[model samples]
Target: MSDSAVSTSRALFERASVVTPGGVNSPVRAFNAVGGTPRFIRSAQGAWLTDADGHDYVDLICSWGPMLLGHAHPEVTAAVQAAVGRGTSYGTPTEPEVLLAEEIVGRTPVEQVRFVSSGTEATMSAIRLARGFTGRDVVVKFAGCYHGHVDSLLASAGSGLATFAVPGTPGVPASSTALTLVLPYNDRAAVEQVFAEHGDRIACLITEAAAGNMGVVPPDPGFNGFLAETCRTHGALFVTDEVMTGFRASSRGYWGIDGAQEGWVPDLMTFGKVMGGGFPAAAFGGRAEVMGHLSPQGPVYQAGTLSGNPIATTAGLTTLRLATDEVYDHIGGVAETLKTAAAEALTRAGVPHVVQSAGTMFSVFFTDPAHGPVRNFEDASRTDSTAYAAYFHAMLDAGVYLPPSAYEAWFVSAAHDDRAVQTVLDALPAASQAAAAAQGGAR
Candidate 1:
């Protein structure tokens, strides 16, 4: 994109910053990590995003995994439009929510689900239910496994093994995270140690079905199953936060690839993203036995005025109903091709890198292959961000928009046709070259 093309976005961002912190509703959208004028998107269609300057780029972020069928999917738009005509929200229970809930139950291990407006609400509510059911005060989570900004979940690892976490952000008080335990992702020994030390006091252990926020880190084989078993032994709920992977990793989310075949089920699971189609809808659910402890069924006390908004549920329901096996298969195929092309391009440009994936969701780390796969946040942190920044801008200039930050999954959609795939394939080599140059002769 030309400087002339970026001028409009720059102007819009300036106007946005006057009213919004960091000039964006979401911090990552500010482009602080990549160092550029973040594009102000005016519209999107299929796999392409048109910025205020009218430059169209292949959208690899896929709205952070919600646009599984891609932007402006005809069926989803039409359904949402029809639902809107009936009324946007009733502030009461609705049929669309029930149908969507039933769809989730049929596709995943969750026997019951409660809808919420955002992934943050979904995880926060799940944590509360777990504590209510188990009657415990402590919560455990892995580092780099973002379960939204729930105060307790937003925490940094403490100085010692099994120690209580410190607040990850300023607004979160020490007391909020006082009962939270933070451990390294994929560290089975650390998990064992934490549980052994405070298993009796723990309410639940929550994790991403696969880590995506810290750039795709798949759990070790049998890792999730092990967590489930460990949680069961300790009488703590095992909650997988599938906010980014639900219905995107496969038809049933990552569990379909791992848990169903392994024959172990989580005690609770949180879902968002693709399940919402392109709307702000999320849900948390599990076995009816445990879910019975929530709300009117029992006395956990959770409520939302617009929890089951008809429009959001209709978009979500329509999207899921259209998300057939073919959708996943097509997306997976495209992802594989792009992964190979990127690796080859970077290799040819003499850039050392590693591409890590959890099923179809993946990220290319500008780290050394010598370090092996990025299994944890520490390893993911080793990725060369400066190089990634150069690569990100190069790809953006070349008409393929990747995630602005290095530590994020590059989501793809079924709408990514050969044209879109070719755009990404065509951009890799040059972007790799830019990255190599940024690393001082690919040093």
Candidate 2:
């Protein structure tokens, strides 16, 4: 059917369903939680997405935090184009990879790094390296803190898993999660208890530096530092997953918010999103001592055919080079404005809600105000997802593209100028009212 007969997004989705599972490669992209036709984006520029139907929406999701400098950023595009002319992949070491690694080491605490194709690979490799380095089998992760789809890490993940109400997936067997200890986020007592019970057997404990996957639930004051201290005491590696927050939350990512100031650093860190500048690139690195455990230096086996693709590294390197203090300041300012406007809009509509932030990244939870400041998965689960569904579609109709899932972070970019910000601000009040109306199925 043509777009005239049916909405282009719906038609395309129907066609895609014949070939791809759920008509999307990624589950959350299907809009399963928030019911609607997922807009098929044709192109993006600055902070706007032009859909297949020719409607342009202010892009608040920012490709889930990769477009820190915004879609098709001129400098980053030029860098990728230039690198492409040289060639795409070499399957061999490249100067861009070295430069990117140096840039990462310079900005963060990681001393050495290894490139991968996705955040999942970066994290999976980090965990394996942790196991090899510690000679232990157990891994600990926090509830509502997503590290990716690695078998062990997926036990109680957030993001798509949280949105779809899947406690854990099927393909992952019981044995896979046997050694995984899932703890509540921001609960130091829980961490201490877990370490007390399994300290010797624990290889590593990984967490989102600040939990963005569960809607920007930040670590409590001194919580990350405490995790680091406890891990150090127990001889377990502290693995901070910055895949979502790296470079997007701040110049040095979420770690810059507290870890740097408190003089605490994770033994390992995973990075992606903004570092790739929208390309398929990611990395994990840490103290040279721990990283050295990976072969051909050590015994832990981790390899990727496209580990350091030239063009991807060039795009990432250029993006990082351009992500200056001013870029972060601009994004931070945009986040503050939008967060305040969203909270006010929700209040005006008498809709229960809470806005939470971890540096420049944030999310609005459609939950009872009394139950909020969501700290863990249980608290996060209390959000009224149906109300968010209404709010999301209302904003979509009003020329604002938000994260389709309520559990995901809403990203802003340095390119979110006055026009884009105003577009979002204009949409919030009506969306909030839609959420209010949806409370009792009135909408």
Candidate 3:
């Protein structure tokens, strides 16, 4: 097909611009960083996306890390369909909510879990509960760690905020973020210094279990464990925001890689993405002692109109049930293959790059590893986004879709079979060359 054949998406984007802010629901989806028309997807199945212009590409974003089993898995779709036939939403308590909550508790260290409609809600409510429980006014978050777009967490956040180069969101009052201490991601010294100054006043310190939003920057050895210990010492709750890493990174999430092995658990945890089975379900939970502070059981009040909606819960529960060790094994194998292939291709093309991972989740950084791992947002920001934009467009042209921005993880799923993986491999050499030839950020 000719390049002009894809004009349908351009037209749709133009129409959307008139009605929607930035012509996209999410900031990153607008392709502003990449400088191209974002493909308007009509449908996705298994590991492929079919765009409105009738071109099909192997999907690598996986709805930004929710489609662990890949898009529209037969079993998950069947569960959601059966749930829909019963009824869409019922504000009343449902069996699926209890079952889903139980599944989460069984897998992680949480004794109880509370459902929410989105990751932002989960993190927002988690922070509120922490503040109320500790009776403290301050929160501490890592600079590159994103815990959704919650006003407090958005201060110096990763993901979209980092991708767009926003220092901190404008509308969020300075007072809202004044109490939020932003520190470097893997720097124990910075975390220690901040805690030494404000430990007693801190309600919670939240970090991504593994920093996926800033392109899969995994925690340094024992970094998360150290944070948990410090929080314990300082009487502040350690909140692990696993919205992107949960289930997709591993069967039990990044905690399964670190906490499960190291025998340290967070005081609180937030989850979303794969647990919802491609629906809008998320949660926050921890020890029953901490969770008891929320709602009718305690003074801290948090409620949602769509909290524990039946259909969403059903989808989440079913997805969690089907996420066995085999699913994680398959995803891991695919990620390993792709990571190796991408690194090799970049090296062959004489492109300076670094590949990083947190279990099955990973990303190829456009910066050289000589600068060291991207432990914080500053390091992540040093990436060659212009090189990546060229690489991304080349891959898109080769019928393989990559994340539109350099600071996002390239997600793989159990559905990324040899066929899908081969498509990506076939596209890599040319993409790497494009990246090598371009002057990053000069465009």
Which is the winner by TM-score between candidate 1 and candidate 2? 1
Worst 10 residues of 1 by lDDT: 434-443
lDDT of 2 at 342: 98
lDDT leader: 1
lDDT of 1 by residue, 33-141 (tens): 8898999999999999999988999999999999999999999999988998899888888899999999999999999999999999999999999999999999999
Ranking according to lDDT, highest score first: 1, 2, 3
The CA lDDT at 144 in model 2 is 84
Task: Go through the candidates in order and give each one's C-alpha lDDT.
Answer: 0.92, 0.89, 0.88
What lDDT tens digits, residue by residue, belong to model 3 across residues 373-409? 7777788888988999999999999999999989999
What are the per-residue Cα lDDT tens digits for candidate 2 across 215-267?
A: 88999999999999999999999999999999888899899988998999999
CA lDDT of 318 in candidate 1? 95
Say which candidate scores most in TM-score. 1
Off by over 4 Å in 1: 440-443
TM-scores for every candidate against the unseen true structure? 0.98, 0.96, 0.96
Q: What clash count goes with each model?
A: 0, 0, 0
